[model samples]
Target: MRLAAYGLALIAGLAVTGAPNPAPQVTLDRAEAAPGEQVQVRLTGWPTGTVVIELCGSGGPARCARDTSAQIHVPGGGAGGAPLTVSVPPGGCPCQLRVSTLDTRFSVDVPLLVSGAAPPDSGTVRQAATGPPVVVGASVERDRGWPARFGAPARRTVVLRLRNEQAAPAAVALSFRVGRAPSPTGFVAPPAVPDLAPGEERVIRIPVTLPALALGSYEIHGEIVTAGTAHLVVVTTDHHPWGLAGLLALAALTLLPTRRPRRSIGRR
Candidate 1:
């Protein structure tokens, strides 16, 4: 019953955003490999003046290689493309190849399983604990036209509403970075407001001065972080009636007695 509530809450969150759904983009076309041999990884993408490609081994944070390149120059306003190579290690453990846009400073993660490893069996992986629950959504005024004043820019008010749904109060902090294509070079102050009460929300209005040169696609991400707290969202899986019935049957068996305990061997 508790798990079902979490699912419903997650669904409701989507409705509140009202923002266009955006999907992560990957430029890597394919990974080719031979038995016990090295494989070549090729990636292609956009807004490309310069970029970096990193290779991580066995799903761990350990980086095997960090290759910086300026040769990925897009031609005739074409999409970005680049090719890099990584030697397959002795074992068949899967590896992760990450690509980062140098100028725009965005990153994408891709997983590459080693050649000839057995396919994984069908199963479900569930998070053991739900992390700190932080609600996030963005707002933009569509009808408001861009102001044309030429001096110091006006402070754009960005209000982040944070609600602590846990039983106890939480200390919340907000950290954000400007999206690519007009990224904020310098840091912003008071990354977040702290000490939010349970079942309570605080709207943090950050006054930001847009650079005169700022333009185009911008994105802001906010997260609430605390020590020893789960920082990722937890989602509940669906429960079927058959599964519930099975549990109920098992519970009944615990109460039933076999052969009535020999009728207690009563006298008379």
Candidate 2:
């Protein structure tokens, strides 16, 4: 009789506090990618309803543009899962890919690395003429249309033009910086140009990777040091729309004429 009473009490407690629900989850094939790269994603444990997927900037609003989001319907009471292919978009930045169900309050957030790409060239070499004994040439190569906006990683190439004026061969060291920080990994280092003949000029191409950064203005600086000569080059990334809007507001404020101090006509 005591065992029966205890079992009845346990059942009543369970009925009052329902069972725990499994949380929704999402997984990506990779964690990092350059802009325009394709990534495979798998989702499971969602509630029985339509699900919304979004790729939003880190700390930004929840809903992204249609180009960066997708909607999938899970039928048969959400018993099955769904597989999705997401393409990284241009103007890359650190972001999160979120998945949420319509009926229940179940959601999942996945961190994604959206690396940056170089901007197009303006048909002229961008460099400092007064630095060291090297000339710098930087260009971004991107294909047209979908590839340009949603395909492979854009290629960034930096060409260094060097002329050895000294009689003996010189050992040159090269370093690169992005924004105010050092270059991130996965970038191909500049090749060493040792034993450069006297009065010989050689052009070396260095491949650079522009990782995703916060939406702002960034400067990429490259330096070549050899035989007391230091060649430096600085390139600026194109300002994002938000950054440009801030600049425009600042400029408008500066242009606004300040009210002249009211003249003391009564005193005069």
Candidate 3:
């Protein structure tokens, strides 16, 4: 029931911005394999372009073995393409097969099992005893022609809505970045906001600016960092090249002599 409510809330928030484009599908011939062993991976329903496939452990990039990764070029509208062989990284079982676009506008992760991995001990698990629960959601103003490009620059602000549900107060600094993927670059970091009282809600607006010539999908990511824990949020936008079709049609029209009037009759 909780999962369903979360899904409904997410859908409501992004109904205006539209969901991300469909990503390529991935399949592994074998569910479990020993480390350093190669497995056959099948791909299909790929609309187009290139993506990176890598193996990662539980944590973030720090836990991922970067050496065990590959860049796969997917054919346009691929239909059950040839199998791709990828070796399991050094990290043991309980890992993820990660696939993401170069810009990271779209991403998918599949569970991967590697032999000889030790499961987490049930006795050593820590419960959430510190820090208030922060619920974060982000959205772009699509109603005012957001994501606009071609004729007018497509730049907009991302509104971040945060609510603390628990009884504990929170004093955290907010920092974020806009990119194809979340990395250390071009960040809008402000000093820590006033301490948030228990069960308080706050709204923060961060303006996003993209290059005039920039084209393709982008992401707006925000984070609230504190000593006890960190809260992260993300929203998506695009710089759609609406003039591409018009440009192509114009070029074709130029190649046709019949479409031109008799302005050059005197020269002939």
Candidate 4:
């Protein structure tokens, strides 16, 4: 029975560790295009989530039209594709086609050269400069923690600050996860955020429950997806559950205490 218990412990530990996931990728049909031209994009090995694709210029802020951006849904099994068709925004060249999941599970920026774009000067290319309609910033009260705090499981709320930079109101959907990254199917906790007025800012708080004895860092990903762009803020939190695990191990060992060596009075 003791051997069996040890074996089960080993298995349980392995299960908690989990297997590695295949890295997500984005494959573009062409590398360069003229402004107002369409490019096809294929997503492979991406996990299930809602991803936004947009054609954005290279400098200043992301410049893409609300009508040209596309959102794709990757289904179950990590095997999904989206044949995204996006045209290079007029004068938004020397730009990149940006793709990112709502939870930031997969993010890739594919660069492209657009016709009529100013030639490079000293490694600098000029293009239309504009700002994205929406952007986000993230921070937490505590960035690192132990397994427990004052006898309770350590937990924290990630505070997200969002801004609408456009002159018009922007409505955005907020999706976030704070735990093991790129979960096979562990999508949850999509906090609702009110729409922002022009030049308006808002604050959102997402609370996450940290595992008491699970080892490793936790990922705090918050993304705000508007019609034209999806911006993500990725934060990593360090947690040491080793202290709790060690205590548990010690308690288990105490249940089968080691026999003390018999001391002979003659030795004294």
lDDT per model, in order? 0.44, 0.53, 0.60, 0.63
Give the least accurate 10-residue stretch of model 1, judged by summed lDDT.
232-241
Model 3: what TM-score? 0.40
Clashing pairs in 1: 131-230, 174-192
lDDT of 2 by residue, 45-78 (tens): 6665455566655323212322545555555445
TM-score of each: 0.31, 0.34, 0.40, 0.43
**Candidate 1 vs candidate 2, TM-score winner:** 2
46-143, model 3: which lDDT tens digit per residue? Answer: 65545556676664433444455555556556533333344443333477777655445666778878777654333422122145347566788642
Question: Which wins on lDDT, candidate 2 or candidate 4?
Answer: 4
Candidate 4 accuracy as lDDT: 0.63
Which residue pairs does candidate 3 place in steric collision?
A: none
**Residue-wise lDDT of candidate 1 within 56-162, one digit each (tens)?**
55422222232221124333342444555553422224665665543324566677654665333233321111234466644432213234232223234456566
Worst lDDT run of 10 residues, candidate 3, spans: 120-129
Per-residue lDDT tens digits of candidate 4, residues 1-268? 9999999998999899987777877778888776567777787777777766777664422244335666666667655454444555434456777777754456788887666765323433333213334446677766355436323456767777777777655646556666787542333355545456778878778776665554567777766666535676777776665666677888898899678999868754
Off by over 4 Å in 2: 1-18, 62-65, 77-92, 102-104, 117-268
- At residue 144, what lDDT does model 4 achieve? 55
Error of 4 at 207 (Å): 2.4
Candidate 1 Cα deviation (angstroms), residue 137? 3.6
Residue 266 displacement (Å), model 4: 7.0
Q: Which ten contiguous residues of candidate 4 have the minimum total lDDT? A: 123-132
